[model samples]
Structure formats: structure tokens, C-alpha cells
Target: MTFQEITKDEFAQFSRQYSQSFLQTRQMAEMLEKRGYQPYFVGIKQNDELKLAAFMTSLKVFGGLKFELNFGPIGQANEAELASFYKGLKAFVADHQGLELRTYPDSNYRTYDPKGEAIDQPNERAVEQLKSYGFDFVVRHIGFDEQDVVAEWQYIKDLAEISDEETLLKSYNSNAKRNVKKAIKNAVSVRVADFDELDKVEKLIEGTGEKRKFATKDLSYYQELHQAFGDKAEMLLTEVEGKAIAAGVFIEVGSEFLYLYGGSDGAYGKLGGPFLLQHTAMLHALERGLKSYNFYGISGKFDGSDGVLRFKQNFGGYITQKLGEFAYYPSKTKFKLIDILKKITGRK
Candidate 1:
């Protein structure tokens, strides 16, 4: 087996034949490039056939460099092939003199029903295998903050099970049903916004971020995102009386529709524009024959008063807890020093 850097076209062609996350897409690579990260497509070929591949993004840190593999290392290789791939990955990191490599491999740790009962067990064997490769696992409860590479817990609505919109609405909790109705009564209409209307969506996001005390990316980042994904991305906005109140960014990859970002105005809370906007996105996903509509990340801790979790639960979706991030430090001393410096400087 030989490991080599592959072109974007080669990566895209390979990606089409395998199941991968939207983060692994070439468009995502392009977007990351605009954000100061250098993206590379690395692959292992056996007998001149692609075996395992990953989309790696490298960023320069104070001490050395950091490599991030977001929800990736995508391919259907056996255990031996996987071990060989890791070996090559380690060598690649050494060649680059990277301090650390972070990866969030797409693994189903566990699944929960709508009632929050665990319906499936975690893949402990895979976790153990990764640990054997000297990868340190960061076990975090879902949704506290994305201090890790990605969120561990996700809310996913199985659109494939629903026969129609009416059936889907019926699946929602009573509060969600009422809110959707209220939005309709308040004349809150949801529509797909064009690229020109992204500024309005960004404003809505900024407003919500201010209220929630969270940081938001600038308008240019969103513009680059829209340009990269093109039709695969949809910006849904809910409006009342010709004024936008709520908006969300949804990305469709294969059979999955991911609700990536969302925001709304507090003044329109009574109108329930957020709920309507989500419903509109889900409906669009259903119309497009998508199998699942992902509400994305949520805090793992569940309580009635947790508004964010409650809002997602009311939409009637199962919870998916992923195997969290794993890190490989080429030099432990350098990695620790970098971490300490990052903490001292408040750099994330």
C-alpha cells in the first residue's frame, strides 16, 4: 500500500462512491481555504486502488502546526487496512512536523429513541482499536461547547418514516404543533432565500448570537459557504409582514439534510418563527427525498427547562451520540506547551 496526496477531483470521485459527511466535501475544503486553513486530500492505495482516504486541514499554530480531520477518514476498509492508514497518517504528520492531529471519525456511539431511551449500544471495539493506535479520546458529554472538533450528540428526524407532511406534523409534540399553527396564523411564511438575501440571514444570526452571547462568523464567510456548496445549500427564512424574523442554513449531502446554523429575533418569539423555519426546512428535505433531517448539535444533558434541547425534542427526532474526538500528538511536550499558551492567550 502506498500513501499519497490526491487531487480534489480524485477525492470528489472517490467520495461519491463512499458514504461521507458534508464536511469532507470539496466545497467544504474550498470554504476552509478561505478561512486560512490549507486543505489536503490524502489517500492510501492498494494495488493501485483507493483503500482509505481523508480530507485533512492544516493550520499553523504558535509552536508547530495542527491537523484537523472533521468527521472523516471515510472509507470501507477492514481492520488491517485501517491500521495501515493510521501508520501512514502518523508518518505524514511527522513529515509536516505537526504538533497534534485531531480527528472525529464518523462512528455511531449510541442511538436513543424519542423518549431518550438508548436503543443501541456503542461500538466499543472500534473505540478500543483507535486507542491502540495511541489516539487519546476526549470523552465529553454532548453539546456543552464545541471545545472538541465537533459535537458528540445530534438530533435527527427520520423523514423516511413519514408518509406526508400531515403525518410528520402529527409526530411532533403538542407544543410544536401549536407553535407551527401559531406561526401560520401570524402570517409567518418561510421561503428559500437567494444568495442576495444572505445579508438578511446573517443579520438574523448576529441578532440571535448577541442575545445568546455567542460569537458568529462574518457575512463573507457565509458568502463563501454559499458559493461553494451552491444548490446543496439552502437558506430558509421565516418572515412576517415582509420582515425576516428567523433563518437557518441547511446542507443536503446524499440522503441527509443537516440544519447547520439558525437564528431568530426575540421580538417574534410569540409568532414561533423558529419552529416554522425548521418545519419548512424539514419539509424541503422530505420533498427532496432525503432520508434524515438532522437538527444538528444539542447538549447531552436533558431537562425540561433546557430550551434548546426542548425545542429540538418537540420536533420528534431520535438522538444520536457520536464517538467523540480523538487526538494524536506527535510531540507531547510541544502539544502541552501549545495548549498552555493557548489558554494563557485565550485563543481558541
Candidate 2:
């Protein structure tokens, strides 16, 4: 088997034939590039058949960032093929002195076992297999049942065949309506900023990180997104008393309106700044005829009862249990050493 890197243009060509989730799309990768991430691709071919492939996107930290060997939209391959692909991947990255290569498949492999049957919840077999390869498993708060209330609002496009406003409002929880009204009473303004406002939007993100104890990318990163996505991307900012209080940047990827990055001023939380910002985005999505509004990346640890989960529930979205990282680490010595440590620590 041969593994080779493809150009961005080449990857774009491959995307059409092979299906991928929004995260693996070139647009999303470009979004990450705007945030200064280094993205690359690797494909395995043997005698004219492209049997397997992977995406490696690196975030270079001063110390070290978690490097992932993401499987992209391709779910579980034939076990033998996947194993061979993993071996080649391990060899190639090891030669290049790669650090912690995590495999986060774009598909939700955990939700369904190898036989393609939905288990009661996430399967433990795949998690155990990856662990044997010296990979850490994160049993985080990220799973969702399709029948749950949050899932109904999230997958509204599927909840009912109709897109009429009256029908949709009936689907929303009472609390969601109350928050929307509260945001209006607070005089919070939500509008999509033009691409020219990238600078201000970037500042909002940076300011939000500082005030809320989160991380942010450089301003130039977002500027590039506006240049690339043009009108397809949007930066929504909310303000009160002429001060920027809340901001979120989202992109319409395929049928899903992804909630990419969001932040709000700590002082404005009580004023319903974020509530207004999110509600306005949803309305804008409806206007554009989008299928669903995804409040992305909830904690996998939170049960159906957590306040944070309840907050997202107000948006009326569904929970999707996405597969986490998996990888095959070479170096028998290092692999075995880490395996012992992990077994003793009982940490994934």
C-alpha cells in the first residue's frame, strides 16, 4: 500500500465521490486554517484502488497539541484493510516524528457496532480496540438519543415534514419562547455582520476568550474565512448600550447550520445577550430555509438533567453521538510502555 499527500484542490475533487461529514469538508478545514491550523490528507492505494484514507490536522502548540489522524467521513473499513491502513499510517508519522495521532472518525462508529446494529448506547468494543493500540479514550458528554426532546428540535427538518413557522413554534419548548421574548425586551440587537466587519468580529472573539476564560485564534484567521466563504459564512454580534456584549460565528454547511464559535461578555449574560444572539441566528437560518440549527459540541458528561444540557435543550436541537479519536501507534516499546501506564491509571 502507498500513502501520499494530496493538495487542497485535489482533496476537493475527492470529496465529491467519497461522502464526508461537515467536519471533514474542505470548507470546515479552511475554517480551521483561518484559525491557523495546519491541515493535510493521506490516501492509501493499491493497484489503482483507493482502499483507505485519513486526514491529519495539526494545531501547533508551543508545547504540544493533540494531533489527530481523523478518518473523516469514512467509517469503519473492512477490519483487515483498516488494520493495514493504520500500520502504514503509524509508520509514516513515526518517520516524521509525529506526536499523539488521534483518530476521530467523522461517522459515529460508537453509536453502531461493527454489525451495523444500534446498541443501547455507545459500544465498548471499538473503544477497547483503540486502547490496545496505545490510544486514550475520552468517555465525554457528547452522546444523544434521537427520540429525546432536544433531538426533536435539533432535527426539526425530520421532526415534521412542514417548514411553516406556526408548525415550528409548536415544536419549541415554552422556555425557548420565553428566552426569545426576554432577549427582545432587553433590547439586544442581533444582526449578521458583513465580511468587512471581520475585524470587529475577531475582536469580539478575542475579548470573549479573555473575559470568559476560553481560547481564541488570531484575527487574521477569521478574516481568511470571510474571504473564502464570502456570504456563505456569517458573524452574528449582539450589543447593548453601544457595547459589544455577545458574538457568534456560524457557517451553513450542507443542510446543517453549524454553531461553530460563540462567546459573550460575562456582564451581559444576565441581560440575555447570548440567548438573543442564538435566537436571532435561528431565525436567520429559518429565513434562509435551512433544515436544522445545530448547537454544536455539548458535554458528553452531562446527563439529560444538567443545566447546560437544558440550555441547549431550549434551542430544540437533537443530540448526535459522534465517534471520538482512534489511532494505531507504532514503536512496540513506546506502545507497550504507555499501555501499562494506561492500564494501571485506568484513564482514557
Candidate 3:
């Protein structure tokens, strides 16, 4: 068996033909590379025929030496096929003198326990396949599902069919529109910002991350994404009395609009500014005819956790489980050492 890089046309064709669990489009790879990451394609072939496939991307941090492949959507691989694929990947990493290959498999994350009785619900067979390959269980987030308010987004629609006000008032629920109106009444203005205003947007991101205790990339990342995706990426700001109170950084892919990051001034919590910003972004998305606006990660740990669930529910979108990362560690010692370090640092 050998590995080869599949061309973009071949990759696209394969995606349309197969029922893979995850779809990491080639356009996304180009976007990642534009953001200063090294992206590669791997095709595991057997008997002169392609058997399995995967896409890998790495970002150089703290200089080019320290690197990690954040996520790779590995094409379907059975038990033995997976084993051989990992062996080949390990050899490739070794040949490149890579210190480590950290993969977040898009199909599975945190699927098994040490005893391997399926510590989690084993949502799919692929989840078990990941366990068979010996991946550590990690809990990065929990998800939410509110079905009563489910709605689909459309990227292109006749404006005459559903105007902005009609979609905003209907899609966001009655109260959501009220809050937006309250924001405008309370002197909050939402507007799109030029690339030069990234500094202010970055400040909002930092503030939001600090408050939420999550990770955030620097302004350069957002700038690069905007440059690469053009009109699809938007940086929006909400100001009160001429002071920036809230901001949103988002990207639109086909009919899907993702709210990648959002934050507001903690000091202005009384004005309901953050909610206004969120609703406004949703309104804009609906106006543009997006199919669905993904609020990103919701706290899945709390199955009945109303607080977090309710936060996302107001947007009128159904919550569904999207798969997370899976990885194959080449060195047992390195894997163990990193797992120990992650545990010591309170990471799952």
C-alpha cells in the first residue's frame, strides 16, 4: 500500500459519491493554507488501488518547529485498514522529522473508556472504530437540541418572498425582535466594519474569551480569513452611544452561516447589547437567505442544562451533534506523556 495526494477534482468527486461522516471541503483547505497553515492530502492505496483517504493540515506556532495538525477528516477506514493507515502516517511524520501529529478526527471525540465498554453512548459505529484505534477520551464541549424552533436557511431567495423585517420578526421569535428593537431604541447601532477596524474586533474577541474561558486566535487569523473568503466573512460591530459594546466575527459557507466568535462589554450587560448583537447577526443571515446559522459549540455536558441550551435556542435553530476530533498517536511514550500533561493541566 502507498499514500498519494488526491487532486481537488478527485476529492470533490469522491465526496459526492460517498456517504462519509464528515465533509471537509477542499475550499476549507485552501482557506486554512491562506491563513498560514501547511495543508496536505493523503490517499492510502492497496493493490495499486485507493483504499482510504485523509486530509491533514498543520499550523506553525512559536516558530516553525512547534507544529500540530489541528483536524483531519479521515475517509472511511476499517479496523485493519485503519491500523495500516496509521502506520503509514506515522512513517510519513517520521520522515518529515515531525515532533508529533495531533489529529482531531471529525467523526469521533471521547468515545471510549480505559476498559472500553463504551463509556459514552457510542453514537455511531465510527465512534467505536476510533476507540479500536486507541484514542484518548476528551470532552471539549457538550451540545444542545431545541426542536420546536427548528428552521432551515437558504442562501438565495426572492427578496419579495421574505423581506428582512418579515424574516427577522418571524425567524428570531417575537421576543427576539423586541430585544433588537429595544437595542435600537436604547441607542445601539449595528453595522459592518472595514478590515482596518480589526483592532476593535480583536479586543472584543479577547474580552469574550476571557469571560467565557475559551481559546481565541489573534487578529491576524480573522484578517487572513476575511481576505481569503471575501464577502463570505463578515466582521460586525454594535455600538451604544458611539462606544463599541458588542461585535461578531462570522463566516458563511454555502447555505450555512457560522457564528465563529462574539463578545460584548461586560460593563454594558444591562442594555441587553449582546443579545441584540446576536439577533442582528441572525437577522442579517436570514436576510441574505442562509439555510442555517450554526451557533457553534453548545455545552453538551448538560443534557438538561437549560441555561446554555436556552442561550442557543433563542436563535430558532435545532441543535444536532456534529462530530469532533480523532487522532492516532505514533509514539506510545509521547502519547502517554502528552495525556499526562493534559490531565495535570485539567484538559480533557
* 346: Cα error in model 3, Å: 18
Model 1, 1-348: lDDT tens per residue?
888888898889898887678888999999999889999899899998998788999999778788988887878988888888888888898799888898887888889986668998878887888898889997645444453226677888888888588998998999999999999998899998988999998999888766654446678977887899989899888999999999988898878899877899898799989989988888889888888998877667665534566779889889888787888998888778878998999876
Q: Pick the candidate with the highest lDDT.
A: 1
Candidate ranking (lDDT, best to worst):
1, 2, 3
Q: Can you give the lDDT of residue 329 in candidate 1? A: 91
Tell me the TM-score of each prediction against the true structure: 0.92, 0.70, 0.67
Residue-level lDDT for 130 in candidate 3: 56
Task: Find the number of clashing residue pairs for candidate 1.
Answer: 0
lDDT of 3 at 196: 93
Which is better, 1 or 2, measured by lDDT? 1
What lDDT does each candidate get? 0.83, 0.60, 0.59
Could you tell me the TM-score of candidate 1?
0.92
lDDT of 2 by residue, 1-348 (tens): 666665666566666565444556677677766567778776666685666555567765332333564435243367666666666666666765554566664445443221223555665666665565555665332333311111111221222343665555565579766666787798878877776776677877777556534446666667776666667688888887677787888777656576666776776677777777876777667777777676754434343443345556665644555555455444546656665776788844
lDDT computed for candidate 1: 0.83
